[model samples]
Target: MNKLDLKVLDKQEDFFIINGKEFNIGFTNAEKERSFNRNTEEGIKELNSLKEEFGANEVIYLKQIHSDKILNYIENGKSIKDEEADAIITKEKGIIIGVFTADCVPIILVDEEKKVAAAIHSGWRGTYESITFKTIEKMKKEFSINVKNLKAYIGPHIRKCCYEVSEELKLKFIEKKTEIKKEDLFCGRNLNLEVCILDDLKKAGIQDENINSIDLCTYCSEDVKLHSYRKSQGSYGRMFSFIILR
Candidate 1:
């Protein structure tokens, strides 16, 4: 199989498209519109447009809690409520699986053979909890995918340059045995969250060549195309990462 090609779609929305699939992922500004708050109706509408554009049928997703729990999306011909989970997987084509993020990492996995896909939200909690690996393991077990055949993508989020974590959060990750080398742990002033998640992916058996971990710093992007919880403080917006097998 060829290496996966990752492309940016709707940069204004911080949206992305995987080359071989029929789904899309993007971000939204919650502070700008009251209706767009917390993956609101407006955001869903934008996502639906992408689905329709790609000729997808149904959408599936999770209400991310930054935990390791992964849900399977069963097609019911309706939008799924944001249930508490960090990851969601599905084999049903046309079911869009979405996950919301601000600074946290958004992960997508696809099995070319089985036609199964996943959308995962990984924050420090989910990273320390190893949600990414857990999700991959679950997919492999359920879909019988060879680890090498699975393709992965890590979307734009907070980087080490701006993701500041107190000593407490750092210690928590260290306790979980996540390899946060001292150099990558603190970038003069902030913790490098990208490093933590990247290391986790490698540990989970994803080859380095198969992952497209964008280096875009949401906090420092002068264009303001993507949302940054750190840059905007607590009043920031959100970006949605979704995928559907088609």
Candidate 2:
């Protein structure tokens, strides 16, 4: 199936080898025209199929408001239904956690040693609030996850190639992330969310070598099948990216 084509986290050692290179983390494409938004019949069916595809009972997600609010699956009694958060952290196994994204970053973090994992949705607002960094801090506090042993997978999203922002927004972002050089953060008025995310991850004490990113840009990648909100002008649907401690 096209969903298995990317093999997104195959290069990483965080996943268990359940069935021959099978991964616990996954990033899905727009194959079969699936949206996984859960607001319609097709979306509900697609989301359930994803549960089957990942061999998990359910997929936990958030009613993302682009804020830095993070949730703990266990604290919610090991199950959540549309929690108001941007990131989810879980230390349990076999229960999938995920986020929906279009032209926004979908980040999966794992502590292989401790069997803890997290799924984060980071857009421009989330980025400004240091959502990725805060998620790591929460994981550390909740699960005692060591940043050095944490592996991160940054899935495809709108990069600087097709993510030009307004001058005021750019200035606000620049004002917040003063550690990164302006030239490195921006490509001539096009804000690079990847760069911003990288800085956040690094600042959170995650080693650079443990961080991996899909080079494809959702909004501009010619050959990639991932969806893009800006490219579709918000007319289409979002792709789901998830991870589990399987």
Candidate 3:
């Protein structure tokens, strides 16, 4: 498996204001052992430390099948084993919703007015199925959240500079988004997953300015110590992207 080059940074937290309410969003660093796999005792310890550090009442995780499935946590309640889904949404506060990713996009959506939050795991498959769009629609239906009041924070993932895809896969994306230029999708065999996701977010009715992307490519950022599954040749430790309502 690939290992993350972990580092401790001063500005590891991302703060957001929704409806005048402030929430702190954090992504785990590669500096420490932060995997959630129960097989590794260290991974479990690291996750516990993180929960204590954040003072979160509960940390929710999913099995992550890379589909468009979105779970409503408030309705289903917590689970002893990780649930199988690509996204999770909740209106309950003090509970942290998280998704694990190495190269796939980990996206957080917050409805400032409704105090509703969602975490989505969008790999190529999930993105292809419009998981982000589905998550937003569920939030709107369940929490009555307006699109205008939603803010999105896109976490770091593999970028076009390092993410090469098959021609067959490229054709699939083109089929879904006919308006996208062929050149934008292909960086000489690499697919720009970030662009595809941002386009989807806009099409889902999120304002351009409201979408905050970390813009860091995990495969390209060896200095900052983000994990890249491709870089490790499929052996990579997953990073957890989490958000909670306080």
**Highest-lDDT candidate:** 2
Ranking by lDDT: 2, 3, 1
TM-score of 1: 0.83
lDDT of 3 by residue, 47-87 (tens): 56666777777777777888999988863554723668999
For model 2, residues 117-164, the per-residue Cα lDDT tens digits are 889999999999989999999899878888888888888889888899
What TM-score do all the candidates reach, one by one?
Answer: 0.83, 0.89, 0.88
Q: Candidate 2: misplaced stretches above 4 Å?
A: 1-23, 75-79
Candidate 3: misplaced stretches above 4 Å?
A: 1-10, 13-20, 75-81
lDDT per residue as tens, model 1, 3-86: 322344344333445556543434333333322234567666765665676567755556666788888777764445656888
Which residue pairs collide in model 1, if any?
Answer: 27-239, 59-96, 60-96, 160-192
Report the poorest 10 consecutive residues by lDDT, candidate 2: 12-21
Cα RMSD (angstroms) for every candidate in the order listed: 3.8, 4.6, 5.0
Backbone collision tally, model 1: 4
The positional error of residue 218 in candidate 3, measured at the CA in angstroms, is: 0.8
Q: How many clashes (backbone N, Cα, C below 3 Å) per candidate? A: 4, 0, 6
